[model samples]
Target: MAVAQPKIDLAESLLSRHAAPGPGARWAQEARAAAAARLRAMGAPVRRDEYWKYTDPARLTAAELAPAAPLEPEKEALYGDRAQLKLVFVDGVLDADASDALALDGLTVEPLARALATDIHWARDLYGVLEARGQDPVPRPLAALNTAVAGQGVAIRVSARVATPVTIVNRQRAADSDVVLHHLILLEDGAEMTLLEAGPAGARYNTCLEVDLGRGAQFHHVRTQGRDNERHAITHSFARLAAEASFKAFTLTVNGVLTRNESVIEFTGDDAKAHVAGAAAGDGRFHHDDTVFVTHDGVNCESRQVFKKVLRNGALGVFQGKILVRPGAQQTDGYQISQALLLDEDSQFLAKPELEIYADDVACSHGSTVGAIDEDAMFYLTSRGVSKPDAQDMLVLAFLDEAIQEIEDDALADGMRERLAGWLARRR
Candidate 1:
């Protein structure tokens, strides 16, 4: 199909700023070229698009980034006390001085730039493979653009069950910085690894992560989007699970002017499990969106999606999730829930939860709800001599705990709980 002139112009304008990677392997060159073509064909998202109707894409796709002053650092960074290998990026560039050594036992870690430069490497087969597969049934032009141009991120290959986690830290130093990052992760059979991501990447940030899990492999991920009131970001996560493999991811978002996160999961092997959950809190002038697509192609597979949001003072939240069970995917169990608590009359939540099952034996369900805080619960607490603000904060925490409980790691879950409590306390 021929692309519209305006779409071609927009794609070209973004591509003009980023040249194809220099002196790379043949496969890498081809992947970038193919991604560029895909982006031009699909075009940048607009409000008229079916998937983008709830949120505007103008700020994200604009020619220039809107300036966002960095926020003051918290007394302690998220997961700072945990023992892990750290990779730090300042204003979208890797900061060696602030990062730990890349060397780790039972794992091969290298910068994405170097990985793409190598003629022969395992990443060659996985870098853009999953992201390309995720494009089908839905068009993700931004992810395609990132695959074509992003040069700063990590490439990790896990060979065994690593005791420690790998953490990626992003920090913004410039008010007008625009960051594009792409990460590739591959887990071998019987391997296990955990990944942690935190911080506000840039004033305008675009990132994509592609993960592939072999048979019996397990991958756990937890992330916290930093508090930067004026920041704008769009992120994509794509994962493929093999037989008996497990994939779980949880995210906590507190503040941002405009934020959208998309996750695409494909199950290719039987007896696999995948869960994706998120909790978000927003105040005035805030907009948060979570979009997820999970496909089950293997028999006896399981998938879950849980998302919760708290909005107040005209903040808006959006959730769009779908579960697709193929013809041969019998005994597939899928569940999805998206709910929001509106503190005032002005706040709003929009949800679209869908389930499509071609297999007659599959069990799939989805639900979405929006409402205010429970007045009965509030009255009970207030009658017990608890302060109104304190009672409200407690109820708010309870409302968000369901999503937070999806995290497998107790310590990480505790950290997230504390962060949510602090955010609520500050408002009180």
Candidate 2:
């Protein structure tokens, strides 16, 4: 089919602004070219698109980014006290001086640029591979753009169980910075690792992360998007799990003018498990969206999607999730839930949950709810001496606890809870 004229023009215009990846291996160059071609064919997303109808893509795909003032953190950086190998990126560019050495006993971490430059590397089979696969059933043009032009990010490979977590710290120093980053992670059979991310990447940021897990591998991820009220960002995570592999990820979002996160997971091996969850808090002028698609291609695979958002003062929240069980994917177990706690009458929550099952011997369910704080519970708390604001904060925490509990690490979960409490306290 011929590409739409407007879509071709938009893709060309965006590509003209950025240079292609420079001096990479032949395979890598071919991958980049393929991605650019894909973007042009699909075009950038607009409010008219089915998945993007709730969240406008105008600001995210504009030719130029509006300046955003960097907000200084009022508290210490998340996961700063934990024992981890940290890599710092200032304005989306790697800052070697501020980052610890990339070397680890059981892991190999390097810049994406260098990884692509090498002719023979394991990343050849994984980078951009998962993102390309995720394009089916839905087109993600932004992620395709990132894969084609992004020159900064990390590529990690794990061979054995890694005790220390790997953290990527992003800092926005320029008010008008626009960034595009892509990361790849590959785990060998029986390998295990945890990945952490924190900070506001840039005034306008687009990032894509691809993970490929071998049989019996396990990967855990936890991320906290910075509280930059004026920042705008769209992030994508594409993961493929093999037999008996496990993938778990959780994200906590505070304040941002516009933010959207998308996750696509495919179970290629029987008994594989994947869980994707998030908790978001948005106030006036804020918008947050979470979209997830989980495909069960293997028998007895399990998947879960849990998301909770608290919106007030006219803030808007959106959630779109789906589970697909292929014909031969018998005994598949899938669960999905998205809920919103509206603190005021002006706030809005939109949710679309779906299940498409082809196998007869599978269990799948989904639920979404939007409501206000319990007035009776509020009255009881306030009557017992808790201030109105404090009581409300407590209830909000309790409401979000389910999603927060999805994190596998206790210490990380605690840090997330404390951070949520601090955000609430500051607002009060």
Candidate 3:
């Protein structure tokens, strides 16, 4: 249950010798120092740790990591053309000129650095919110590492009875560098919002996003990871919902050498709802993992999760999901499913689903399936005048469309479908 002391000592020594907290590291003034101490105390997680048995982080060394830097003026154009409200962070440093704030009513968006200087109470309360509640051991090093050196991110609040969408685009373009830490937080109350996050890399990227929803609030988050072949990227998302609130998150990954998308969601208020869904297409030696943890802590809360993956070439796909219902969470309704399609014998898929419940009144179930292309279905399609490659691609798309079709946004779904289709063509 604990990492070895020698590893902790070594990590601490290396971190102390090479890493220093960034300028204006918010949440806690000495957060990096505090995290370094915590890492020293907790050490790194290993395979023996049940939570980390599947994915290992010990292979990642300090030498493999590098601090993020500021973005250039010319590169700012990439974000401006894609997003309406853009906040750019280069190597963990906020670029004020690259971001143009919107003066929309009932919506507030500002950089975490600025907010920390002005609103210390909110910043302090937000710091370590996720760290204090984590149960896994694998992320101990990552959480501590990110907490210690997280640079400028964002904090946005949508007022009561309001509806607004906030889009965040993160770009990592370091051709020869280390790792970049990106943090983002979104809070809404009786409001509706959308967060569009894009990570394209030529570097290593680790991003942590925290979202809090108040009563009756509705939030939609779409994340896209399309980094270069050599880039390594990981995203950690933590979300909590209040009474009658609805939280929906969608993720699509088509790139990255090694990418992991981890999400932890909690329904803490009665009648709260959450839907977590993702689709990934991997090829050309890419390794992608999607992990989701959902907890029902309040009576009458509900949650649903669906993940689909398509792997080709020598690519690998993994999905690990768990749903827990507490003793007091009566009438909790939770469902989870993960399915993967292997395009070739060299391609691979791993799906694991778990359910732990202490409530007798709760209804929880989980399912997973891993298989190759259905030859009968493909032949049926080919007989209907469909080309061999096109038929196979169509069947793959149809299998994954069940999850994507549940999305409420038509334009977003269409765009994601197009991207998946293009990737399938390349696979063929």
TM-score of each: 0.98, 0.98, 0.89
TM-score pick, better of 1 and 3:
1
Model 3 agreement with the true structure over 378-406: per-residue lDDT tens digits: 88988999999899888888988977875
Cα-based lDDT at residue 425, candidate 3 = 79
Better of 2 and 3 by lDDT: 2
- The sequence of per-residue lDDT tens digits that candidate 2 reaches over residues 241-348 is 999999999999989899999999999999999999999999899999999999999999999999999999999999999999999999999999999999999999
Clashing pairs in 3: 32-148, 66-178, 66-179, 68-91, 69-90, 69-91
Which residue runs of candidate 1 sit more than 4 Å off their true CA positions? 73-76
State model 3's lDDT: 0.70
Model 1 scores a C-alpha lDDT of: 0.91
Please give me the total number of clashing residue pairs in predicted model 2. 0
**In candidate 1, what are the lDDT values of residues 1-428, reduced to their tens digit?**
66677877888788776655576778888888889888888887777778999989889888877999975666225696779999998888889899999988878899999999899989888877888899888888889999899888999999999979999988888999889999999999999999999988888899999999999999999999857878799999999999999999999988899999999999999999999999999999889999999999999999999999999999999999999998999999999999999999999999989888899999898899998999999999999999999999999999999999999999899999999999998887
lDDT of each: 0.91, 0.92, 0.70
Worst 10 residues of 1 by lDDT: 71-80
